[model samples]
Target: MSQSHTSQFALLTQRRFAPFFWTQFLGAGNDNLFKFAFTVLVTYQVQVAWLPPAVAGLAIGALFILPFLLFSATSGQLADKYDKARLIRFVKSLEIAIMAVAGIGFVTQQVAVLLLCVFLMGLHSTLFGPVKYAYLPQHLSERELTGGNGMVEMGTFVAILLGNVAGGLLIAMPGVGAQYVAWACFGLAVLGRVTAQRVPVSPATDPALQINWNPLSETLRNLRLARESVAVFRSILGISWMWFFGAVFLSQFPSFAKEVLHGNEQVASLLLVVFSVGIGIGSLLCETLSRRHVEIGLVPVGALGMSVFAIDLYFASRGLPQPAVSYTLGSFVAQPGHVRVLLDLLLLSLSAGLYSVPMYALIQMRAQASHRARIIAANNILNALFMIASAVLAGALLQAGFSVPQVFLVTGLLNALVGFYIFMLVPEYLLRFVALLVSRCIYRFKVHGDEHIPSHGAAVIAANHVSFVDAILLMAASPRPIVFIMDHRIFKIPVLGWLFKLARAIPIAPQKEDPATYERAFQEAQRVLREGDLLGIFPEGAITRDGTLQEFKGGLMKILQAQPAPVVPVALQNLWGSYFSRVEQGTAMVRPFRRGVFSRVGVVAGPAMPAETVSLDGLRERVGRLLAA
Candidate 1:
């Protein structure tokens, strides 16, 4: 729980996480597998009196989504009110019973009964949704939150890929047919129940709270809880938007492959497989990319990449040879510029992982534990709504005579707008833009002792400011967001000043120069710490003219004594010669481009010490040792 394990995969070998993870994985797979098999049956084989196949597809989609709208509020409350492990077992048991009924429907081939199965499966998923996500924060350490969520998401997409493949293959089998699909669902349900049984005890978050059985009122209550925190609410919106975007892209894959790429079924399958693989790989890399922290900085970067690749995909698909013969998967890849199109799809999916994992982690980390499940349920409701809107919009556009590629072009452009609006709404997303730009593009950055940075709670980062960009490097490398306390002159500088404002950096002046400004800066810094946000300051007061550590100022001690927060010692290494630094030893005039591109730099964090024990000498010594290390 301390995040002692460095690798996310290491969690798979731990008892606390392993069973719950597999239970969810198998359960997700079964849901998709059964749904795909049934949909295919409804589309091609069944001769139903109720509706046509196209209409049936819409009906089934509506039926599945209806349960989330109706039942999610109740399920979210139940998760908070009961032992989660036991609740999971109950859900799996229900799954088995539903599968048993589904088996009967399969044999009878009753369209109404199969539709009932679809609705039942949706109900099961709705109940499980909150429990699955809310369970992780209870088990994983905060440092593990991002990695853990990433693993779950990667596993989920992998399950989806396998489930879709297995569904089609099993349903089309000669003798087994629907029976094989039914048996598989039942077996998976049983296995899920077995795994659920092995899950560690997860006590109710709020057992004493009374249940609200009224769906409509309870649903509104959950939505209110989700909106309680603007950050969490915005994060939920980001997630819902992702679902909308994904739904639009995936809903068109079949038609996109056949009509646009002029490819057969195998080619469609190939596109899906590539997309899934890319997402899975990207999800796994999130932990490393984020430096084992819940780095939402990747979210804006992901949104940017997603839109860019989607637009490129439109270009990659344009003016292609329309052959008389349908292309096989191999032939599709072999076509001129087709591989580029595949790359776009893969990158688009990869960026989807980047966009989503952090947002999920952010919600989990920030939401109140007592109402976390209900908040997730609220998110589910919105996701369903957005997805439904996507379907309707896509249908309307296609009806209005837009090509699939053209629709993608429109979707991509709309994504850019949506992503920009969200970033404007939440400055955290914009801050991530700064972190990503500096860390990924400007510098080859590395961090050591990142685990020493506390995952939560108030702390002051006392670092030696070796250069103007020292704060930038520290901001990028720190596990948590840091509010740098800097000189007002530095805070007033051009483009850098704008970034400082976005980062919420507190600006100070010397008491003699401006007492009001100095006092205000201290008040702001204390406020940040009291609010449990990280406060970063250069105890050296300004960037060093020489690379050697300067005598620490007394202001840091005064601030720490007043606030009583933990002090984390940070040292920026190998940045003295950068353009932002006074590298010539005594000159104010600075070169604009001396460090060149992709300069190697490092940040090292020492263990956090009590604020009571913080001193100018002690912090300077600690940071000096770290810099020398």
Candidate 2:
């Protein structure tokens, strides 16, 4: 997390967060432990008459996911309609019982019994998914949300890594065999439930809301509730697609190491370890890179890396010799071309962590608080659907003669297309990417009183317009998206204009210059504020001809009359002398040739004023005070 924000590690010490965190971590660890143990049993130890090991693996995947499909809707409603802490405790208890059943299956070596345990484990997870995520927003502050999610994500993948290692080692032990794996599962389950008992109470969001026991109708309703917001719904799609992309990479690892890298179980475990570690590191980095804000800018960065690394992994594996038998871990690493594959896996997984944490935080922050659990339930359903699709698609492709590396190639290319579509559909992700890039590279920007900005809801921002880059500067500093109101002429510029359009900036023309454009801009501004979006306007209405405060105009008065949102007064300092500003006293549009590349700039945000108290003179005074500081 940022220096300004509370440490994510500190969260582990808090009563409100620690118990729930451990409960979820232990539960996730238990899931992977049992799952991988089953895989080991099928692959090496046990013989099944009905199906081949490969087919059994596919069936297990389907069986595990099926419960999510069947039970997620009911679980979502339960989270919303009952006490979340109690629901979590109940789910944890169910996990203990399910693991007991799994232990018996392992002791007796009954494949059917083990498979049923997988389905029951899935059912247990489906019930907890909604409650686990929704509980965060209720307990943590908005500024803590990103850091909190980072810790949770980091803990989860680390647990997964440990579980995979433990499961493989336990199942392969000489004397104990599957018995140790079974006992470990039972113990972890019990520990998770015990930890969950200490979680602070989380009251029901909608206690009186009718329970929908029917999975079919409740699932439909859940999806509909998720669809209520375009941003929230699209974020869900981004998350679901990430799972699809990740499942492809992960599910292929065992075969990829054996067939492509010609390595044994150790090498296979190495790949999983690298991937999980990459995700854990990347997840923890999200808080720092985002300055402890739920910055979606990292999403595109992650998507771009996912494709690049996947493509590179394909090329790295090209022309590899096929050894008759798998190599030892040392022999595998000593191979000439293997390290590239490892590096690609690390980078790919890191990007994945960067990609997912923010989307999860966004859903938690943006979704209606009342239905947040159900929204997460909707996300779980979609994730399961995508994972199932990945399995089917990969199976079809492999059956159709696509090699593992080729599948990586195809998925990487598909990521580019899907990522582009998502970014276009929700340009906020793209805009934030640009904002972050510009802030780091183009300017040494600093912000003061940024906490005055609200994390949610409608507000009006009145900033002194100094440069053409003013909106970009403000947008870079702002945690949330701001719909900037720009002069119509500036809006018609080439490359920057396209970026502004993507950001959904409103272009205003002076009434005397263009009446229709002026009317439309104000109308659009009103609509934007009414929808609870941030609307930014330059009180001066245009860039200053001189490096001085221009008179605050009456257009703000018109906007306030139409839609009264809380007015946040802001000022941009030292940008008047920047390259983009009109400080050079020349006819040229830009003077980058005359100015230094990285100039120091600051944005100061004044305390928000009530709608009724905002006026032209008052705003001018407030912005003037901030500018002077």
Give the runs in model 1 whose Cα sits over 4 Å from its true position.
Answer: 1-6, 585-597
Model 2 agreement with the true structure over 27-110: per-residue lDDT tens digits: 999999999889889888898888578677778778888989998888888999999999999999999999999999998888
- TM-score of model 1 relative to the true fold? 0.95
User: Backbone clashes per model, in order?
Assistant: 0, 0
Q: Evaluated with TM-score, which candidate comes out highest?
A: 2
* Model 1 clashing residue pairs (backbone): none
* Candidate 2 lDDT trough over 10 residues, lowest sum: 586-595
**Candidate 2, after superposition: displacement of residue 300 in Å?**
1.2
Q: Identify the leading candidate in terms of lDDT.
A: 2
Judge candidate 2 at residue 340 and give its lDDT: 88
List model 1 lDDT by residue over 335-355, tens digit each.
Answer: 877989989999998999999
TM-score for every candidate vs. truth? 0.95, 0.96
